[model samples]
Target: MTAPEKPRSPLARLFMGADHTLDRLLAYWFATCAFYMASLAVLVAEILAGTTPPQAGLILIGAGMAGVTSFYLLVRFSQRLGLEYWQLALYQAVWAMGCIIAAYAITGPIRGASMSLMLVVMVFCTFALRPRQAVALAATAVVCIGVTMWCMARLDPAQYPPAVELMNFILIALGMTGVTALSGAMNRLRARLKDQKAELQKALERIQTLATIDELTALANRRHAHAVLSAEEERIDGAPGPVCVALLDLDHFKLVNDRYGHACGDAVLRAFADAARPEVRNRDLFARWGGEEFLLMLPDTRLEDAHRVVARMKERVASVEVDGVPPALRITFSAGVVQRKAGEPLSDAITRADQAMYTAKSTGRDRVIAA
Candidate 1:
């Protein structure tokens, strides 16, 4: 064993929840804040280039407003209204591309420097969008760049020379394609990792199931039975009535294995389990304790009622005939029933039940004895 989980207070929801509004905003902020930092760095670059950083005070404020407002709109409307990831990525990309282009137009002679912001935005979209959607966003950036350069060339031919604008267009095209290739590679790696994670989770569940279940009878194994008893012991006083335990043993099981061979013996045990399963209630637990024996635990059930349950099991099992075994073969079980004593370890109760089971065996096999 492990200890039970501690109860959590109501206020823990603020930070504990992953889907709660405040927690989601805070989680999103970690990624969103990086854009804010990048925008500040862009302002610094403009100042270093000896160009007037237009709206320098407003840059940080604008970055904050854009990041937060987009998230708010995405969560409250776009996401809530059930838009897809590609739609959300495209939604953010459109407005973001507009911001980057506007920044480039304002920077005058050092307009080429703003291409880095375009790279950052597209790469960020790569994580949230499909390959086709990312390509669409990149293509949109390419079109915006071409139009901005062509118009700037016409309006201010001195500041934006035709030769320089043509060269910038070539460089921007290459950068966008490089971003497309990067997104394709990332999507492949992420898909591979997701598949491996799913396989690992399935393997873990299979192992856990094997550990608790008996392979032969498909019943809870002794380890799981012990664990259940320990759990019930923790709340013995809180229960409505005493907890009853019954231990059952097949009479002369060794003779069946010896005379009919192990194959037939295995069949007999499986048949007995099938017969006994339906006799136990949903709230009660019946498990294969070990070789030639089974255990039952009934919480909040009296010893008399528990005895009746086992007697019922005994009656059902008496008529069971295993397939491929001798047709004359009859399966039967001897049982011992005991109610747990106050504050006593359940292990002790199981021992008493075992003693009573042996008493039933000695008296006449296929009978029930209460202890």
Candidate 2:
């Protein structure tokens, strides 16, 4: 899309970028902001109810909100640095974990509920991180939870019982493990689907080549030539310049096949195409019309220019040296060039070119004749 046309809406403007990558990063960043706000609300309730120390609670909440703002700015900066979404996302995930640990340390009996928050973090990671990354984060969470619970219980036995903390750790570990496994399975499935898509695209390209090209000469085939001719004919009325059609035939193809072998004849045919291909312009098409004949469609060309093109190709093909062909066997072609007129049918133009080619053959073995 053009630059001006991209994302002018107020909602899209808030993200500050029209790029799809930046949009996704901002999406996650916005989600992070919402999560932090909701978490602060819960912590505030605890502070009001006397379950958490108000002074410590306010400090933690302020720091958490500040961190959310900091991450948003960093995420925007990462867009300019060309960093990937996952890099910042992984870092934000770690920061969230830190906030959870801080909140757990300052709360009373409700400290056990931090395991649920940790579970939410693990599940959120599966959407962004790869399998290995998700597993690493899960492992880190396990260690942090264990250490925090051990310290809290030793400091206050009545508040955080050792048996209760142990059960919470086990449940947290099991939940994170399950989410990581699911992430791994999803990553594997995505890879398999990507491979299948590439293979299918290659197969379609091969099929298109076979449909439009001659395998032997690597030139457009008879069917493709017809299509191009029809299009040129249809555009003749308003075409910027004249369109020319030419038919060419090998001078002594059958004699070469009879004397040397079909192999040498095939070699000569391929050599002629290699010699003639360079003479063709971007607006022209060279096609194998039949067994020993070829057709050329030249757009924005006059009869004389088209004839000169074929004449140059004839000289090149005459000097070509094929691997199996004898030095005495010089390959050449006789062609008929004609400029198509307005309102003329494609078939009639081709018939005229074919007749001119036969006339060239009748007058001499190798020459270009324009009609």
Candidate 3:
């Protein structure tokens, strides 16, 4: 038999799953440092071939080591120091400039790879820095490369003629400027997309809330209550417990609406909902079934227990006083409680509960009945 494959460790998975901006920044830093070190090795080889002085080669190696060390330390400690994006970008720009200047000083700006290094620095800055900062860094790179080449040509005419050095510097400057503009445009587009995504998420949340909640009483609507009922019925099918449902209707609601205006009736309805909400457990679903009627679902509850809960809620509702209504005015609700049979459909249970509620209304206005 083939050996079973071992699962990957959590630490390995964590490293693989890390794709945040900080991870990208660290990857870029490491890649750039590696390229610089490779270039430094090449420069040393050129020195041994008598193309560069030994003293300049030594300086280049030392500068390359220092640059790598600085980048490593900054990346490792940046989180603890709470460095922000712009701060990291500024530090990186400064570090790149320092490395470029040091290399130019050692290898003569026009004859060595200093112009190419400056182009790499500009590209990385365009990616890492903000728009205005990237533009500023590009301009600084242009000026630095131009000044270095000019000074080198003026000091050594044989190695770097003025015309050729100026032309090369202009080409490098143009390239850096183009990269900066493109990166800025990309950054702006990315920012706009992020904002739009956040707005879309909030819109979706609002839509979900409106779909599930009743507008007047701020309770779950009939549709959501039915869904909860169905879920509870399914859960209790194989379990050794009961799921109970109660249908409640306000007593003499039509009379109240006729005596007082619809505004006062709405206030009474809202007050009843507020009073009854605290009586039910958190896991129970109390939703507005329709005008002046509500449904409550209790999971893992017995019929007698549900009857007692409804009795308490009925007493609470009778004591509730709507604002602007007279103290003499009273409110009461009649409830019908039913324990769902095992494997019974939720619609059948609701119908039975509705019948019981009507029976309670005919027998007496303010009482609880179980079916």
Candidate 4:
């Protein structure tokens, strides 16, 4: 036999990733805003400096425009190419690189390079993408930083702080990258655990539903009714009140099955169950007692009240229509109802109800006989 299928892993389930076009668009808008804000800050700072240069200001503004426009295009590409989270992360890394380079050009290397500390972007990505994708992002960030440093070292030696300071800069970047990677890993673990719990809960509920339900008529099955009656019996601690039990059976059910196909008979049984469900009180328990028969347990109810409920249910059953059947397709049920006698076993109450039901069936088809 083939093994049962297991659920897919959380990472595998995130196949769409940033392909959710709306999400990608929103992310791009936020990144664009960040770029604009960063550029504005640098522009104002350069204005404050006594040695403000016209070329530097234009470069800062140009970089901000490019970052925003590039992001807009990337968002459209993500939609067209159906990019996943990993691909989006790679794109974000490239965007970060451009921002860092722009900052370096406007300011010098040491002052501008600090902007690459946008490793904080990973925190947002951790919650946005899966762990594997986040890891991909950390790798990309490292590459971007290395490339930016190499280019700056060759083009502008005066911008480099000192050898020791450069070493410190690399160490700080690595440290921040480590923090982002660790946090992303923890978040993914939590997400996976939550998914597993939800799956388990649904599976357990299905099992319990199957155990209590009658397969034929979709009514509560016999085992459940017996368990409920036993529990109700235990609740009675020599109290003044008595429990009421009712047994119901379809009259001439065998004859109906003989006249119509078993499928039609099954339909009739289902109709009967549906009719009975509404008549039962919230506190009452109803179940199929096997083959055209049913049991009802009414806690703390008198025999008279039970009889009234049963009468209403029987009337409803008789009124039900069996589709595609003959006009004379009227059906009836017989019921036996009894209240618990002091010092009597729960089974005795059931037995009394059973006898009363048969008495109604023998006397006539459609009626309740209370004991």
TM-scores for every predicted model: 0.83, 0.85, 0.77, 0.57
lDDT of each: 0.80, 0.85, 0.80, 0.73
C-alpha RMSD by candidate, in order: 4.4, 3.2, 5.2, 12.9
lDDT of 2 at 164: 89
- Candidate 2: where is the Cα deviation over 4 Å? 1-14, 18-21, 35-57, 227-240
- Give the runs in model 4 whose Cα sits over 4 Å from its true position: 1-161, 238-240
Which portions of model 3 miss their true places by more than 4 Å?
A: 1-73, 101-128, 233-240, 323-326
lDDT of 3 by residue, 1-371 (tens): 98764555687345423334356656767787788777788787777777767987787688778877776667656777788766776777777776676666556533546657766666666556778888887788778778887887888877777887888877877888887888799789878998999999999999988888997898899888878877776677757478888999999888888988899899988999998998889899999999999999888889999999999898898888887778877788888899888777767887888989999999977888999
Across 302-362, the per-residue lDDT of candidate 2 in tens digits comes to 8888888999998898999988778887898889889887767767888999999999999
Which residue pairs collide in model 3, if any?
A: none
Minimum summed lDDT over a 10-residue window in model 3 is located at 12-21
The per-candidate count of clashes, in order, stands at 0, 0, 0, 0
Highest TM-score: which candidate? 2
Q: In candidate 1, what are the lDDT values of residues 161-201, reduced to their tens digit?
A: 99999999999989999988899789888989999999999
